[model samples]
Target: MIKKFVFTISIPIVLFGCSVTTTPNGKQVDMLPLISDKNRYLIVDDKNLSKAEKLENYSNQLSEFYGKQNSAYIRVLPRPSYQTNDRFTPIPFMVYEIDSNPVKIFENTMFNPNNVRITEYAQHDLRIPIGKHDLIIVNGLGNSRWFTKIDDVNFEKDKKYVIGADVKKGQNAQIFIAEYEIDNRFKVVEPEHFIIKKKIIENIPIGNLKSVKVY
Candidate 1:
């Protein structure tokens, strides 16, 4: 009886000690670089500096980093792809890759939570090196089985750009990219939308970048 009790206890202990293997079998990918450090300068300002002077200083910083003609800022909007009646509604997109390099967006499982505000999860912005860049976007629906590729996007210097996608049910999604000039107040002004000439992918499976499950 003593041996049986010890054996039963050991079985549970062994099971508890065993680690569960989480094969990257989900759409959740690696985290993207947050805007905390990059955008911190936007909020913190000198008490004596005028708004125009501050903007000029920021512009100088951009010139120092990537030269005056080769730097641009881009912010990817957290716009919805499609809405479903399921638990996860209003599914937003994640940038999978840019210029053939993985964006590795930090996955936030919540479908745009209202009460819980995480700054990293809220913004998908990045300071991209200017020039032609290929972009790949994916959604966190159906385990990231959908994707779209935008190629050869030429980014010019001293411009602030915004990009977003809108998906229609059973149809191709439209990608909207707009450029704006920065004003003396450091605000984006003079909006201009770029016409997309690249082929718009409706949705496709992530074959190479996918995760497999193991039971």
Candidate 2:
């Protein structure tokens, strides 16, 4: 009968293609349901309006307020003719919070160790909080002159914090203080002779307490 109706229509097409569902090293599993109502109308509806939807709903409410807690400060200025130049020359800076992810923080020897020899103009400070950081400055061995500062700091938890300062370039400028640890988990524990090459600055709006100074 036509080979019994071609083996009964190929046995329900081989049992509906073997009713898929494998694993144990067989690999063939796709439960599929990754948000699909036409991709949920591409989000953004904050009650709906115009003007680009109230500017993307105030930019997602300032990206959830810096994505939660934020703070940063890194100021390093050394250019009294490179303070004798011998190597160390880093200048990378960053800050973020407005929506998280953009934290390389700062660089410039963390405010010291660039041949430690300053001759005047002085300022050093490294108070970091809010998240993501890395600052390095070094060229120390002879002439030095490093300065940095970012005000509005008031952090104390188990004490032990040094913002920034390292000088030795000319007229009686002797300052070297670059130690840290003000709670919120900022890093860069000493030892550096110029090696800053990681940077990421995005969103950034921690209530506009934005202070990013680099040189």
Total residue pair clashes for candidate 2? 22
Per-model clash counts, in order, read 2, 22
Clashing pairs for model 1 are: 31-106, 32-106
Best-matching candidate per lDDT = 1
- Per-residue lDDT tens digits for candidate 2, residues 104-154, read 211123434321222111112333443333322222222221222122234
> Cα lDDT of model 1 overall?
0.44
- Model 1 residue runs over 4 Å out of place are 1-69, 79-91, 105-122, 167-170, 180-215
Name the lDDT value of residue 143 in candidate 1. 31
Question: Which ranges of candidate 2 are over 4 A from the true structure?
Answer: 1-67, 82-127, 130-164, 168-215
* Cα error of candidate 2 at position 140, Å: 7.9
Q: Which ten residues in a row have the lowest lDDT in candidate 1?
A: 114-123
